[model samples]
Target chain A: MSQADLSIPFRRRAGRAMEDAFLQEALTIATTKFIGLRREAFDAFPEGEGLRDRAREIKEATLQHLDRYLEQLIGNVERFGGRVHFATTAAEARAVILEIGRRAGARMAVKSKSMATEEIHLNEALEEAGIVPVETDLGEYIIQLAHERPSHIIAPAIHKTKGQIADLFGKELKRTVPADPEALTQLARGELREKFLQADLGITGANFAVADTGTVVLVTNEGNGRMVTSLPRVHVAVMGVEKVVPSMSDLMVFLAILAKSATGQKLSVYTTLVQGPRRAGELEGPEEFHLVLLDNGRVDQLAGPLREALYCLRCGACLNVCPVYRQIGGHAYGHTYPGPIGILLTAMLNGPASVKELAHASSLCGACADACPVRIDIPRMLIELRRQVDEKRIAPWIERVVFESFGWLLARPLLYGLAGRIARVLQRPFVRDGAIRSLPLFGDWTRTRDLPAVASRTFRERWNELERETPR
Target chain B: MTTRAEFMARIRAELGKTRGLPPATPARRPARPRVEAEAIRAELAERWPEALERFRHELEKVGGVFYRVATLAEVVPVVAGIARERAARRLVSWHAAELGGDLGPALTAQGLEPVAMPPGEVASAAERQRLRELVAAAELGLTGVDLAIAETGTLVLSSGAGRPRSTSLLPPYHIALFDRTALVESLAQAGVFLELWHADGAPGPRGAVISFITGPSRTADIELTLTRGVHGPKEVHAIFVEAPIRG
Candidate 1:
């Protein structure tokens, strides 16, 4: 419940979010608006199918040949008067950026929105090192001020209402702040603008990293990408290895989908492509540029059926349209990345050893894959991960025992019949109005939906009577 | 990390490990010789004129102006009138025949000084402070759109000659010009425009992105309340040069 123990499974922590009515309403409103906007943004367009297809092809091909592209990208970025760092894990990434922060003498950092930072807990790292990491995006800035982590990907503060934000800011600043979206935005803007002016380093994330041109593309509705990339003396972009594309041409395919997929705009209000820090003649760019490319578990995913999962553009379109995600919301997923995409991402990044239960959270309905812009087979990946966990003996003994009993019943007809008869007898205690009202060992399910009662006559007994009634 | 070759070899080994990718079913290919771009352009042009008008109306709703001009000859005289009307001093426009040496001489002769904007100066705070110096000292900013969208009635600009991203962002007043063909049905069509710009057929990766300006630089950033031209151009002028595309 405290910051000291934040690594608990989503199931345990999600209850707190589920209990907050304001968070529920805020999430519902924000997601509904986003889903509608995305639908209206790309619905029945000629370019929709072509854009998605091209994006998918580009991602799959990049994952297949990722190392070659990454090397070329790194070389070209270095050639363009920029530095490239390869970090294989979150710790490595944080350490690399922290070192950059130290080298740049960054007392303060102004950043655009980055999910990777949330995954790595970069703010905590910066704060520990006596560096202030200021989030420039309005939503992120509000949440940072409140000392909370992002509940959603694109819009991190999607779960909090204006009233909650006002209350938090009021308490923190020792002054009353109005609970209006307009007023709250203005107050945060006034507060963060000073940080941007004083920042020594600007941190950002890449929407697409073009290898051929050694360009990092950032698409944002707010001008934060530009401010973060250009204003500060040193600019550091932390990107996952999967964010790379082969060429500028390949970058075009993603640029087509990311805007409409994320916010349903023709393009983000601002899309800045940083070729290599500051060129000699360029007047308004960082003096030095550092790109930290993190691998972590992406290389492992690239060689398998799960490679398609790497094709994600972080459009959040999949999350927007998912039925289960819509019902349970992003906070319920409990991982830094939540929803169907989160399920695969958390398992992959957390490794199978740490998360044996997160894999089972999926409904296996294939909705996530259906809604995926790059078409990651999420349900398939979930199933594969479950298999890997079983094979590696990472699954809990109770799960193994339950499934063993399932196999036991299937292999023995007499035992299966006897079990059915006993279940019917046992149903009497719990049955209320022909539905099982209360059952042990199954509260999470029965609490929400009614459990159907077992039929009175066994199929075998009915079959035997029918055989007797017939001319046998 | 690992050697790039070892990384690639792992892929080859994986390919060998699995059955070869499922055989792709053969399908008939479209029997088209080439894209008839001229025909498409002409059809687009016809629909785009009305689309431009509709777009102009939309931009107007968001506090923008739509001007219809016939000739480059009229453009200089009109800009001079705007300067005289606003008591302007300095003006910034894109590097085109529409606002070039030919027109520069005419504007000077008409008692108006023309200034070309430096590229990519918008991102610099120091440059911004300097531009604020220039913008406060000056009266008007003029630039050409990189492209325009018909569906949204938006203008797309990038970092290029005459159209400095900073000039558009720093100046209080901006005037942008485009042809009717700049109009697309919607943002989806605009994506195709961008993809085509990066396509092998078109020039590749023109710096940054296609910045679509539906109206003036407006933001709901200040307390989620609508404020115009806080960081960019306060007022915008969208001119539809309703004439045939000169080759």
Candidate 2:
């Protein structure tokens, strides 16, 4: 589901995803493989633990003085003959890029995988303005052809099967290809190569921008980042303000652990460091370079509850390990980002009310925190978000009433015991197998899960009886 | 549109509201990057054989072909043999100034058509376009490595006056030549060299990009089935010359 399609409600979307057999198998295989790969990658590298801490420290440090680092980044980018633009909102970001494309007379823009651009829905705007935006990454290309959002961060089309992608390729290219991955990949390579050569504008998202050197770093496995930054006459990099690092030293710390967390590779196949526009004596590279610094709610989070989330590297490790994400998949989240971190990011970008339902999506398992390279304490922030949602009265009235009544009852000993006794008698008809499988007024809660029947005896009651029976 | 002043002001406001954040500092940068880089070089001088062995093993693990040769002259035969095996003849290479030594004549003598990129920027756009097309059509790309990271088996190549970014990128097969001089034990040590390159008043590569290539371009996007050469070279062969090519 698209961001605009959230009207369907997250619960129904999740239910639909759970019922899809193909998606179920796909999510299991894909997330399980990624979890194993990430584990193995870290297992082989003993020092990864220290580096993850260092990486976390660097992210926090940069955020503490984000203003200073951003200024340095802007100065150096301009010093290197690149232009810097400030965008405070997604629409503003889209406008800034659209104006750049307009001025450059760009007919086609080739883009690498970028959640920032995706968040802004840049492709639709570009197409509306008559500039063709081509997604160069194979997964992104497949999704773009299908008019779908990325279901996974690193593997955009993880929800897709080879047969489905072969069909996508066949539809887009007007030729049928086998369902083999290698054949499909070769066909996409041939298709995107032409776009790389012929496109007038190259757009990308910076994995990290070095403040001292004014370099925008892009790490990709398929080399599309390099192609996007190198091929076209005009290049624009849209990046969140949090992506800037203090120096090259800090960047290497992230580089050491980022790929390990995402994939098992020690480093991605290509780590392209783009300083600025092409220099005078260079034969290739864009002549004009532009870096768009995107705020779009990230600035508010410095003092907001989701501040630690700013340290997110956009690695999908959290998604792979998330129980909700593994079961329901990304589309159920109904936003640009999906999964545990995606919930916080969605809240960060859209606000607390946006994730009224998504906030309760997690089981608070803490696997995401362990898998997170930066250790952002996702569950802590998630609970915080849930509180904010409740405070704002954004939760459904039924949920608010139930939780508030429960809180009220728990605050008074006599009332709590009385309510428990009443609940035990009322829960008899719905009780089966020692659990409440359905309820007259709480079907929403029992639809996908079971509520433990008020135990045969309350814990407080049990404790009191045992004390009375014992000799004192 | 948010102006720079407004953007910075808002950031400063949010930063002002932040309370009791953990005390954390970024990674310590080298005080004198050039000095630290030289120290790393001297340290690696004795440890380079071990570093080289680790590099070879890691590179081969990533599906990259690793070869060790005595000098730059031997690089041509290896390139020719790779070409013969694939039935490829057309090759593109960096200029001799950037590559450390000329291999075009030797490669040509071995029945390969070698195109050396312009030593500096071409003044005419048409000529630049022609060069891009030439590199795109070439079957092989040959360039010299600026740094060979042993820990990750990565080849670091910076674009500059004589080094075009497309030489290693546009071709199907990439063969990079490096020596003991370019070997760095780990990414941390490579960081020192990178710091030196960007240090105040330091002379760095003139071009706009530096690429760290670990293996050929790969993806597991479709069915999570790993595929190589999705957009970049399919095969990467690194030739390690015992004698430093610059000398």
Candidate 3:
């Protein structure tokens, strides 16, 4: 789905999510459970706080010298007999992978869970080129079969129920299946196993690439990351330039906190580090290895407002703790990425104009920052994005005019007092009890919430009366 | 397409526009990683018993089975028992050179068909294909562990001659053998070994890949319901040997 097709607007998408009874229950249960699990995991690990700081520092240090690290990484990859490609945009990334697929004579490609691939719409491009792209991750596979996109970063199919998943499997596999996760998983295992062995190309996203050693790391629970990199004849790892870390020691700091933040596990089931193509003495591995380093607006963020977001691990912890995200699920954001970090990422990729409505999705709650393993000051960046939206004139005219004029009036005390008096008279007609239930020109804001009525007598007026009555 | 030169130039341009954000540096790596790693090994040589107990405890917490035996010969009975209980017939394993001993004959006597991978690369593509199919069909996969982390119950395996990555990945059940030499207390210590492995060119050719296996392959994607063995082993069994296999 293209951004243009989301013509329904953010309000309608969020409203539809709010009205979904199943989604409401699912979000509450899933996010609540994740919050508990993460708290418990951290409570047990004594060094978690220090590790988070170190991880954040590693990200900052790497970005500071990214040029040097990436060059070293490229040289080492070439030394290990692997090829590297540079992509400045999503379209260029897709083109590079498609060209690799064509040259390898690949008819089928199997993919593990990859948000980068999703961002670039690589599956659609592969299909258009007559090569079948199969999603091997269970969550990704379910969404792919259902012709949908991921609704969560880690738990992609949290919006679906067991019965809904069974139906999806039944329709795709052409058989009746039970509504049991165990049974459904076994069935998928059998089906995807065939694709794993038969597919000529395997694609994955790097969790972290060790710059000094030229290793592409993939952290997964289902081991599809291993299968994709091992079984296919050609392996392609798509990664943002920011995924690179300085050294092996720095990689370990992230390993300590990544899975704990994501799923409360001490570590994920698999963290596979692939250096290059198959070695001379190895029995089974991809003969050809390609690393596609994608810029995709991430480079621009070095000095841009969203520079801090480059430290995101995509752990999905912030989403579970976010009040707005908890109310409205990922799809309501209408982008490849979702949740607090997703809003920043969307602006980084599609520009600030794309996130005009999304910028205000947060209540400036600091819960996301506390929940983040890397401690990204998400609320700070979100406020900056909102300012950018209004400054760029991407926000609605009414919102801009109201906030801008409010700022203008606040700078002058006389005008502010006069405006307060004017609001008191104007609000009398719409005030019900203590709050304004509705208003003219901006009724949309008060439709779902009540705005407090301006006090009958302004504070200045009360103070002036006090001065006349008291000599002190 | 963006050239490497062009991409770096763009990054440098953006970086030049920034000023004093904060003073930060990456985690400090050991100056002589090889020496540091050796020191860790020397310390572990005395504390392996405690580390092994922690490893077993953590492994069991993640739904894995852990066993400690007196010798390499004792591992066969455990493997046979696991196979017997599961009614498994075919087993794929690393070659004797990588595993430290050949258990093919003993495993066959236990009524299991065993196929150990070639010590070096297969001569023919057809042979490689046949081995892959065999691994995919096998019910059990056995290999050796390079490092067993006590804090997280992770088994680190490097892919190289004789030891294919699939021996720990392909089948429904995976069994790994480790000893005191491979035991580590934390992921930080594992990092030291990792740095040492890639340090000064003094050793043989390193493998192209290293995997850290924490538990069986799992997923909770379907409505947050956890299920195991989605694409990798459903069960992971770690057998700790009291007597070193190499010795």
| Best model per lDDT | 2
Model 1 agreement with the true structure over B48-130: per-residue lDDT tens digits: 76677667776776577877888656777677776787787577555454333345667778887766555433556676567
Q: How would the candidate models be sorted by DockQ, starting from the highest?
A: 2, 3, 1
lDDT of 2 at A379: 98
Q: Choose the strongest candidate by DockQ.
A: 2
Q: Report the Cα RMSD per candidate.
A: 5.4, 1.3, 1.9
Per-residue lDDT of A259-334 in model 1, one digit per residue for the tens? 6777666555566777666554344457788888876676666656566677777878777666656655676666
Off by over 4 Å in 3: A1-5, A456-472, B201-205
Residue A169 of model 2: what lDDT? 85
Candidate 2 lDDT by residue in tens digits, A269-325: 999999999998988899899999999999999998899999999989999999999
lDDT of each: 0.67, 0.93, 0.92
Name every residue pair that clashes in candidate 3: none
TM per candidate, chain B: 0.70, 0.98, 0.97
Provide all candidates' interface root-mean-square deviations.
6.0, 1.0, 1.4
Model 1, which residues run further than 4 Å from truth? A1-9, A168-175, A322-324, A458-472, B1-67, B70-129, B132-142, B151-154, B160-163, B170-175, B180-237, B243-247
Share of true Cα-Cα contacts across chains kept by each model: 0.09, 0.89, 0.90
Which runs of model 2 end up more than 4 angstroms from their true locations?
A1-4, A469-472, B201-203
